[model samples]
Target chain A: MVMSWIWTGIVLLSILCAAATGKGGQLSSAAMQGAQAGVTLAVSMAGAICLWSGVGKLMAVCGITGALSRRMRPLLVRLFPSAAADVSLAGDLSANICANLLGLGNAATPMGIRAAKRMVRGDIATDELCRLVVLNTASIQLIPTNVAAVRSAFGCTAPFDILPAVWITSALSAGLGVMAAYLLGKVRRG
Target chain B: MTDYIVPILLFLAAAMALRRKENAYDVMLQGASEGLKLLVSILPALILLLTAVYMLRASGAMELLSQGLRPLFALLGIPPETAMLVLVRPLSGSAALAVGADLMAQYGVDSQVGRTAAVMLGSTETTFYTISVYFGAAGIRKTRYAIPAALFADLVGFCMASLTTRLFFPE
Candidate 1:
């Protein structure tokens, strides 16, 4: 529901801005370019995401994913009680979090999608599913690899010096995001 | 070490499957197929969102909005120059990266604004991108409060990045 509006907002705002700036001629080209980029992105993602999903599946069958999720069970139970009630749903959630923690972003999305798919109980999203999305959005990073790379590329002497700041800010965001989702979700569900 | 993580994980999974006497090849294929199906559900959302994000970027709207929001962002201690990072970080990943990289380029990576931009990128998630992909895959059309809550957290995360950077790297 909100997504529809947000999507509209961006497109409409972009057109309005373009017109106001007299860049109206650029809007069509921009929209088409974006569409083309999305197609390319999806095509590239298909290969990597599927391979990771395959590997992820093998891990699931071998019980490694199950073990990983088991480790995250206590925490997940409190955050996603409804989804946690199911084995595979919790498993995918656990796997997704673990991958994100390691900064294995390519490996995380497939599990995230799998878990999210299972979270669908009806047309509307449940509180637990919303929490899952919230958690992913605020996932704490054990290694800010991409940021470090960018810093080093720019010749920052102590690239990793930002590690401490990253950890604190990410932890704060993740905690606050979870809390916000919980409180807000309760109000809505009630 | 970081580069070897994926291969090592694959090795462990394969080893375990062999020991368990399971057909690893078939299992992998099954997983791949399921994932492929899930991607079908996610691709449309990705395309639409990306289109909007790219359109917004190309039209210079994001920059304009970011510029307009600089004053408000400054009130929260965020550097006025990297105001665009806080604005676009939630909407698009690559765009945020460009903003962060641009900040580092323009103001030396070791500078205050540069450090804050890097930390902000590392700490916060791409909210709209994640929500759309996750919810779209799940076939959940009506995301009641998730967007508001996540965006709120993002706002705080951006402020905290500025705050923590100042606290840790005081001049």
Candidate 2:
């Protein structure tokens, strides 16, 4: 797939650049350090994902997700017309969006996967699937907790000072993404 | 203020579950276990992507690429230093945060470049990671237009981040 080529190209290019720059020694160390960093990142993310996923399940068990899905159904239908009739798909999509809106990217993945699985119509991705991916990719983060946390950690006096900018950019990106997907879907169909 | 949203929502969800008389503890355990499984499933891809990203940065390849792309980024109104963060934003979230933090430290946190990087980081999602996890879970081979569309959105985000930073945080 495209990802394979991208991975290979990055690794190859890293080695090539290091050799060209006479930093081969540094490159070797970087490779090891990079792998170690990856493990640490994953382990850190695991805790957040576990807690949120558990919370998500509790929401479902208590019918909170169902009520949320119902409240969101009209908007979901507009966004994903193909998935309108499927209640579970709507529920999953709503839950995914809710998590994403809260800036819970790690927590949102499981629900996103579940929604995507339901929307896949065989080997090819359905229009709904593509839309969902696009939406998730450009999701508007009302909280943007990670970015704010980083800014605060870096000693920014007003970590959330960029909220307006974040709102504008995210809204534009998500709006354009949905538009692009819809147009692409039309092109693909025709 | 934004930092408390997640904890508040978590508390509300827990309170609701308890009031509903649903065995919240058992359901939570099941979901937590499922989450652990999901984490294990996606770890390989995540690690591979992260390692590649880190290696690219550590090898100075990213800097070279950013320098090479500086002119084009400048033409688009983005600070030359942010070219690397913009490119890396869609690939990995933590990596982008590292780059953003580095920028903030190098330039004063209130500097235009710093604010721009912050907005860019806040607005964008980890596009490649999302695709891999969602599509991998669904067992879909063909991504169709999702990648291109997502990248397009990221591009818009980058532009808007720069533009808004200039407008709202004028130098």
Candidate 3:
């Protein structure tokens, strides 16, 4: 898999660089520290994952997600057609997209995973699933809160002054990403 | 604000489920259990990937690589100043923020480099982190063209962030 190569490549590159730069000690400790931090993150994320998963289930049973699908159906259908054409998948996908749009990242992941699981039929990812991932990867961050906060910390007069730039860049990336995925998917099929 | 939104969302969803009297508690338990299973499946991949990313950061290869790529990035209108941030942004969110803040500090917040750095951080979505987590949980091993396509989008984002900031903010 591609991830396997990337993971090995980074680790090997790190080791070689560490040896050359006399950072061997730091690299070893950093790897362990990174693993520990990973556990911590996963533990915290477990709460979020569980919460969202449960809330998502409840939303489905309550028809909240169904209602959302109705509102966003036209857009989602246009985005993802027959490849992942299932009624329930639409509900999951809508929840994921809406959460990403609102910048509710914590809520988005579980919903995204749920939808992705539904899309998974074989080991290889489908065109529809790839498109979904592309959309999420290029999602428009509505708030840009982290950047704004950093700017404000540095004593910027207007933290959100860069809002227009943020909107333009995010929109461009999302649009281009979807287009790229569509083209690449077709080319591969050919 | 986002903190409040999550609680409110959960409350509204739960409240609606309760109104329907659809064994909401049992439904929640079932869903949570599914999440727990997913956590089990994904924890190892998450740990390994994080370790790799951190090791890469500490080794300083990113600095060397980004520096080497600056001229290439320049062709796409991406400022040389944000080269490191562009490299690190997809690998680790915290590291990217640290880099962005450092850039902003180094070049006054209002400077061209600083605004471009901020926009680059804001516009991008931590591609590697998202892909690993999403596909890892879904148990999809062969990603095919997805990775390249996502990285391409990220490249576009970095370039556009520079162009957009320069146009709107004017240094």
Candidate 4:
């Protein structure tokens, strides 16, 4: 698959570059250090993912997700016309977007996967599925917590001063992403 | 206010489930277990990707590439120093954060380059990671146009971030 090729290429390129730059030791250390970081990241993310996923499941069981679907139905229909009739899919998609908008990237993944599962038709990704993925990829963050945290850590007087900039860029990116996906989908079908 | 949103949502969702007689504890436990499973399933690929990313950075390959790309990025209104962050961002979130933090530390946080890096981080997603995980979960094989579209979006985000920072934070 393409992912495999990309991974292989990255490793090979890294090795080649390290040798060329005489940074072989750094590359070795990076291999071990990066793996450690990966595990640390996974562990740190697990608790939040568990909590959100649990809450998401509870919402589904309590019909809260269904209500959300109904409330978001109109917008969801416009965004994903094919999934409009499938309430569960629409609900999952809505929850994913809601989480992303809130800057809960970890919480958004499971719902996004569920929505994609519901929309995917076999091996081929439908236009709706592609659009859903695109939307998630370029999600507009209402609160960019990580950026703010980094700014504050660096002793910035106002970490959120970049709010307006983030808002404009994120919104524009998401909008353009959706439009691009729509257009590309048409071309792919043709 | 932003920090409380997730906790508040969790509390409300739990309370609502409990009120609905949904056996909230059991359902939550099940979902949490499922989450753990998902984490385990994606660990290998995540580790591989992160390792390559870190190796590339530590080996100075990323810097070299960024140096090579500096002219073009400068033409695009992005600071030459931020080329690495922009390139690594869509591939890995933590890596991008590291680069952004470094940029902020090197250049004062209020500097145009620092602000641009922050805005870029805030606006863009880890496209490759997200696509892989979502598609892997959905058991889809052909990504087709998804990657290109997402990368294009990220490009737009990068440009917009640079432009907005210039406008709002005037260097």
TM-score of each: 0.95, 0.94, 0.92, 0.95
Task: Give me the iRMSD of candidate 2, please.
Answer: 1.7
Q: Which 10 residues in a row give candidate 2 chain A its minimum summed lDDT?
A: A28-37
> Per-residue CA lDDT of candidate 2, range A81-170, in tens?
855788778888899998888788877888888788788888677888888999998968887877788787878899888999999999
Q: Candidate 3 — which residues are off by over 4 angstroms? A: A83-85, B1-4, B22-29
Per-prediction DockQ: 0.77, 0.72, 0.70, 0.74
- Candidate 4 deviation (Cα RMSD): 1.6
Task: Give the better candidate number (1 or 4) by DockQ.
Answer: 1
How far out, in Å, is residue B10 in model 4? Answer: 1.8
Task: Assess each prediction's global lDDT (C-alpha) against the native.
Answer: 0.85, 0.85, 0.86, 0.87
- Each model's TM-score for chain A is 0.92, 0.89, 0.90, 0.90
Show where candidate 4 strays beyond 4 Å.
none
Comparison by lDDT, 3 against 4, better one:
4
lDDT-superior candidate, 1 or 4: 4
Worst 10 residues of 1 chain B by lDDT: B38-47
Tens digit per residue, CA lDDT, model 2, B32-133:
998888888787777788788877877788888888999999899888889989888888787788889999989978899999999999888889988887
- lDDT at residue B84 of model 4 (Cα atoms): 91
Off by over 4 Å in 2: B1-3
